[model samples]
Target chain A: MQVHELRLPLRAEDIRKLKEGDKVLLSGIIYTARDQAHKKLIELIEKGVDLPFKLRETAIFYCGPSPKAEGKVCGAIGPTTSSRMDGLTLPLLQQGLKVIIGKGERSAECERQIREHGAVYLTAIGGISAVLARTIVSCETYLWEELGAEAVYRMELDRLPCYVGIVGD
Target chain B: MRYLKAEDIQKALTQAICQISYESDPKAVERMRTAHEQSNHELERDVLGAILENNELAAIDNIPLCQDTGCTVIIAEMGRELVIEGATLQEIADRAAAEAQGKCPLRASISYDPLFRRKNSGNNSPAIVHIRQVEGKRLKLKIAQKGGGAENMSFLMMLSPATPLEKIKEQIVQRIVESGSRACPPLVVGIGIGGNFERCALLAKEALFEELGRKHPDEHYAALEQEILSMINKCGKGAQGMGGGLTALAVHVLHEACHIASLPIAVNLQCHAHRHVDIEL
Candidate 1:
C-alpha cells in the first residue's frame, strides 16, 4: 500500500490521489462526529439553519471524545464503527465534506455517495485507541456540548494515521 | 456455613473492572501475537502488530486500550453455603461497577434508557449480572467489558433439529461474512448450540469467556470449532477486513441438551481486544 502525508481540510481535488489500501498520516484540523452528532447536523441542514462551522473542504472524524485525563488534550479517542452513520453521510458529502475518517466498512449507498461526491473514506485501526489519541494536538468542544462525548470536537491532529477504505471517483 | 462478605465481592468486581480496562488478557494477547508472527500478508500483519503494540501502550500509560470502556457483564456463580453480610450480590456489583467507571477515567458507555432518553448513566452502573446458585463455598465470577461494536453483531437462530452439520457451518460463516470488519476481526467466535433461545444466547456469551485457542473438552464440539475457524479464515476477510489470513483467532463451542425437535444456535463475537477477568473469592 502506498503511504501519503496530507494535511486536512483536504481539498476535493487532492482526494483523487488516494486509492483504497493507501496509508495516510494526516496533520491539521478535523472535526469529530458520531451518529448522534450526524443526526443533529442533518437536522440543522434540513431546517436551513446555518451550522456553526463550514463543511466545505473539511475532514470529519467519526468519533466520540472521552473526558480528558489531567494534562492530555484528549482521552482514548478512536474511530467508531462507520456503518452506523452510513445513512446520514450523503447530506454531509453534498455539503462538501472532503474526507471522512472512521473504522470499518460502509454501506453500498454510502460508498456510492463518496464515489460521486468527490470524497474519500479513511479507516483507522479499531480499538488501538490510545495510540491514535496521542496524535491529537488539541481538542475543544465545537458544537452540541450538551451531548457530552457525542458533541462535535474541533481537534488539531499531528500525524494521525489511517488507511484509505474508499475513494471518490 | 462459610461466610463471604458482600463488601469483598464488591471490591473484587471493582478491581477487576479497573484492571481489565488497561491490562491485556494474557491468553488473548498470546493468540494475537501468534497471528501477528504467522501472517504472510503485510497489511494484515501490520494491523495485528498495531493491536499488540497498543496493548503494551495502554498498560504502560494506564489508559483504556479502547475508547469504548464497554458495558459491564458479570456472571457470578454464588455458593449456596456462603452467607452474605451487607447487601445482595447484584446491588454490590452495580455499586462496584459504578465506582470503577467514575474513578478510573473509563468512558460511561451505558445509556440509562435504550429508547426514550438515551442519557448517559455517567458511571456505567447496573451491570448485566447473571447469578447462579452452586454447591461450593467459594464464589466465582467472570467479568467482561463488552464493547458495543462486537456485541451489536452477535446473533441467534432457531434452526430445525433436522438441519445438518454443514448447514450449521454455513450459517455461522455467513454471519461472519456479513459482519466483515465492523465487528472488528481477528475475533473470538463463541457458538452456543442446543439450548432454548435465551439460554443459547447466554451460553454463547459465556463461551466467549473461554481462553482463546483452548479446544473444547468434547471431541465432537472441538472438531466443530476447528471447522468453523477454517471456514472463517478461508472467507478471506482478514484483520480489519483487509483480506488475508486469520480473520478469527478462535471459535469456541459450548452446548447443552435441548428438546427433541428444537435446535437453537447463537453466535457472540468478541473483538481483538478481549477485556475480561476471572475472579475467585
Candidate 2:
C-alpha cells in the first residue's frame, strides 16, 4: 500500500508501474465525464471530429457532481460506477487515453484493453463525495452543458485521492 | 375529522429532504462508528473513518451527502380521518421535493421519460410517491434519496413454494457479491419476501428505510436477517469492495403473506450513506 503522488497527463510508463491496491494522490488537470459524455466523445471520434481536449497522457474521471454552493470549488464530486462505461473504455484507450478514474471494477475486456494500452483504472471512495470535493481546486464545464451535471468538465485537482484497481501492461 | 394543511405538509417535506441530504442519520452514523471500531482490516477502518468525516463535512458545510443526490422516493402513511387542504399528498410531495432541490441544490437525476427523450427534469421533481391509508389522524412520511449505483443493483426473483429458505439466502448473497464495489459497501441489505412482483420490490425498497440495527418484528424473519448479514460479511468483499471484514453493516427483511403458490423475493441495496428521514404531522 505505497502512496504515489503523480501529476496528470502521465506517460504510459508512469501508469504501468501502478499496481492494484496502491494509493495515489493525483494532482493537475483531468476531464470529467459520465455515460452520456462518453457516448458523445465516441460519436465524435467515429465522425472524425476533433475532440475537446488532448487525450495523450490524460485521464478521464467518471463523475457527475452536484451543483456547487457559494465559495465552494465543486459539490460532492465522486466517482460513478465504472462498469457502465466499459463499452467505451477500449475506444477511448485506443485514442491515447492513459488512465480512467472511477469506482467499481471494470469488465474483463476493459481490463485487457487497459493493460494492452498501458493504462490504469483507479477507484475513488464512493459516497464520500463531500470529502473528495475538497481536493478539487477549480472546475469549468468544457462541453455538453445541456446534459446538466452530466456535462464534461475540466477540473483542476490537487491531491485527489484514489486507489489503483487495475494495473497496466 | 382532522384537517392538515397541504402547505404545512409541503413545508415539512422540504425540510425533511434538506435534513436527510445534509445530515447523516444518527442511527447510520452509529452503525458506521461501530463498524469502524470493530473492523479487523485497516482498509475497512480507513474507509469507514473517511465516510464518517464526509458526513461531518456535509453537515457543517450544508452540502449534499453524496454527489448523486438521487431520485426522491416518498412514502406517505395518511390517516383515513385526515383531510389535506389545498393540495393532494402527491402534489405536496412533488412541490416539497422541488423546493428542496432549489434550496439544497440537489442534483437533478430524474429523466422525464425512460426511453427516447432522456432529458433531465432539472428540478428533481415528480417524486415517486406512495400513499397508504392508516387508522389515525397523523400523516407519516418517510423519504429516501435512492442513488443510481445501488438502485441499479436491485434484484427480483420468483421461486416455487417448495424452494427452501436456504436457496433464497443464496440468491440474496449472490446479488450482493455481484454488486461488489459498484453499490458501495458496507451496505444495508433490504430483503422483501413473499409478495407479488411489484409489491415485493416496493417492500424491499421500503425495508431500506428501517432504522439500522432494528430487526424485523417476526422472530423468524429477524433471525433470517441476522443469518444473511453474517453470510454477506463473510464474502470478504469488504468496504468499497477493497477486501475487508465488514461488507454489510446490517440486513433488514420485510415480509408479507402472498398467494399460497407463489414465492417472490426482492433485494434492494443501500450504500453506507443511507440517506433517509422520517416525519410525522
Candidate 3:
C-alpha cells in the first residue's frame, strides 16, 4: 500500500524494504527487451560480447511495444508476462541487473536469483498500456531493429507506477 | 435455398475480429464496471482500473486490447438450406483470418508442429472454425479472441452421474481460486455439462462468447449460473486475484444430453478482457 519514489541506478538496499505488493513511482532509465533480445543478450554474455549498456544497477522491463506513430515516444507500452524471461534472469542477475520490471509471477529459479543477487522484481499493472506509455519521456532503439516489436528500446521514464511483486526478503 | 456469398462472410469475419479486439461487448463491460464498484481491495481495484483503461486505449487508438490477439476462432451457424458459393467456406475463412492477422498485426501466437520444432507460422494461420447447421436461413457468426493465459487454465471433469450439483459448483469455484491471478480474474466462468469429454470442453469454451451475465433460456441452468456467480465472487479471488470483490463477473452454464452413466463437466476460464463480437448476416 505504500508508494515509494525510486531513482535511476537503484541499489539493492533501496529495494530491500519493499515486499511483494508494495507500489512505487519510479523515475529514471529502463531498457526494453522481450523474448528475442533476451535470447541474444544472454548469448552475447555467454560469448563474452560487450553489452551496449551496463547491466549493473539497472532495471530491465519486459515489453514489446507497438511502433512509434507520430511524435509519440512509444505506443501502448505495458509490462509483459515475466515467466517467459525466466531463463535469462539468473544470468542477468549475476551480471548485476538489480531490478526486473514485468507482469505476472516469476519462476522459483528467478526468485532464487533475485535473492542471491540482491535483486527484486516489480510488477507494472498489466493491460495499462497507455498509462505506461505516457511514462516514457524518451525512447531509442538500442539493438535488434529487424526484430520488429521485439527490438530493444532504451527508455527514460518518469514517475512510472509499479508494485514490488517479488522481494529478496 | 438460402444463399450466402463467400465474400460477405469473409469481410464480416475480418470486421468481427478487429471490432472484438478493441470494443468489448457492452454487457461484459457493464459487468466489469460493476465488479470494480463492488471490490474493496486495492490490488483488485487497481487491476480492474488497468483493464478498463486498456479497453479505452484500444478503442481510442484502434489497437488490440491485448498483445496476444489470439488465434481466430469462429462459431458459425447456417440454415440447412443455405448454400456457400464462389469459394469453399473453409478456404474463404482461412484467407480472411490470415488477412486479419496481418493487417491487425496481431501477435503471431500460433506455431507449426506444436509438439516438436515449433516454428512460428508467421501469420497466425489455420484458424479454429466450428460450423453447425440449423433450421433458419439466417447466418450467425460469433467470435472470441481467446488469450493463451485463460485457455491454459481450462479443465474437464468426468464427474460420476451421481455427483452432487453442489460438488460440481465447488469444483468450478475452486478452480478459479486456484488460478488466482493466473487466469486474470474477475474472469468469466464458462461451464459445460452432460456432453462427452471433448465436446463438453468445447461447449464450455464456446459458451464464453455469450454476453456476460446473460443466462441460459433454460430456467434451471440460469439459476445455476446465478448461484455459481454469487458463490465464486464471495470466495475473495477478486480481480486479478489481489482479493476483495468478485472473482468472476459472470458464470455461463451450457448443458447437453449425455450418456446415463457419465456426467462430463468442463470449465473454461476467460479473463476480464473478454473480447468478442457477433454478426448476423
The number of the candidate with the highest DockQ is 2
Rank order (by TM-score, best first): 2, 1, 3
Q: In candidate 1, what are the lDDT values of residues A57-119, reduced to their tens digit? A: 468999886677676677788888999999999999878788899989888989999889878
lDDT by residue (tens digit), candidate 1, B1-281: 99878888898889999899887678878877887888888898878888888898887766688888888999889889988889988889889989888777788777889999998787888799998899979789999999899999899999999998899899989998789888888899988998798999999999999987898999999999999999999999998888788789889999999989899999999988889988999
What is each predicted model's overall lDDT from 0 to 1?
0.87, 0.87, 0.77
Interface RMSD score of candidate 2: 1.0
At residue B266, what lDDT does model 3 achieve? Answer: 94
Off by over 4 Å in 3: A32-40, A48-50, A66-76, A84-88, A107-109, A137-156
What tens digits encode model 2's per-residue C-alpha lDDT throughout B1-281?
Answer: 99989999899889988888877668878888887887777777778888999999988766688998888898889999999999988888789888988888888888988899999889988899999999989998999888889988889988898988898888889888989999988888888887798889989988998888796788999999999999998999988998887889889888999999899899999988888988899
| Share of native interface contacts recovered by each model | 0.62, 0.81, 0.14
- The per-model DockQ list reads 0.73, 0.83, 0.35
User: Over the full model, what C-alpha lDDT does candidate 1 score relative to the true structure?
Assistant: 0.87
* Quality of candidate 1 docking, DockQ: 0.73
In model 1, which regions exceed 4 Å deviation? none
- Residues A1-169 of candidate 2 have per-residue lDDT tens digits of 7788999878766777787888899998899999999999999999998797888756899999888877777877899999999988877888988878999988898888888887888899988877888898998888999998899988998999899888876
What's the CA error at residue B53 for candidate 2, in Å? 1.2
